[model samples]
Target: MTSFQFTKMHGLGNNYIYVNQMKEQLPEEELSEIAIRVSSVYTGIGSDGMILICPHCCTCEDAHFQQ
Candidate 1:
């Protein structure tokens, strides 16, 4: 079985499963399926949804940075 680490967090009674993509990655094509599976209360980690914390992509030219 394939497994990745995750953290569960909540605020104001809302909760979600957070996956740090900076440390690991899931296949882009399977993200929707993964979210559904992980969000199931009876079969999975049980959350309102899944959140992927990814590294910042600096490749976007339109992005502006302020000091």
Candidate 2:
């Protein structure tokens, strides 16, 4: 098994699952599947969603994009 830094934060009795990958190696293509599994209310560990704190922010990190 591999170890990584994770911080599970909760508010208003609602909990969130965090998977910090700043210093870890994970396949990006498998995130959605993992999220769905983790957040599933049945047949899996229940949670609101997963929070990913990474080092890079695609192209929006330049702070010059319009939504």
The per-model lDDT (C-alpha) reads: 0.80, 0.67
lDDT of 1 by residue, 1-67 (tens): 2488999999999998988999679987888888888888887878998888777788774533211
Candidate no. 1 TM-score: 0.77
Q: Compose the digit string of candidate 2's lDDT tens values, residues 1-67.
A: 2334556678998877778777885577776677777668784468887777667868664432211
Q: Which run of 10 residues does model 1 get worst, by summed lDDT?
A: 58-67
| TM-score for predicted model 2 compared with the true structure | 0.64
Clash-forming residue pairs, model 2? none
Instruction: Count backbone clashes in candidate 1.
Output: 0
Model 2, residue 57: C-alpha shift (Å): 5.0
Identify the runs in model 1 with alpha carbons over 4 angstroms from their true place.
59-67
The true-versus-predicted C-alpha distance at residue 3 of model 2, in Å, is 8.6
TM-score of each model, paired residue for residue: 0.77, 0.64
Please name the candidate that would achieve the greatest lDDT relative to the true structure.
1
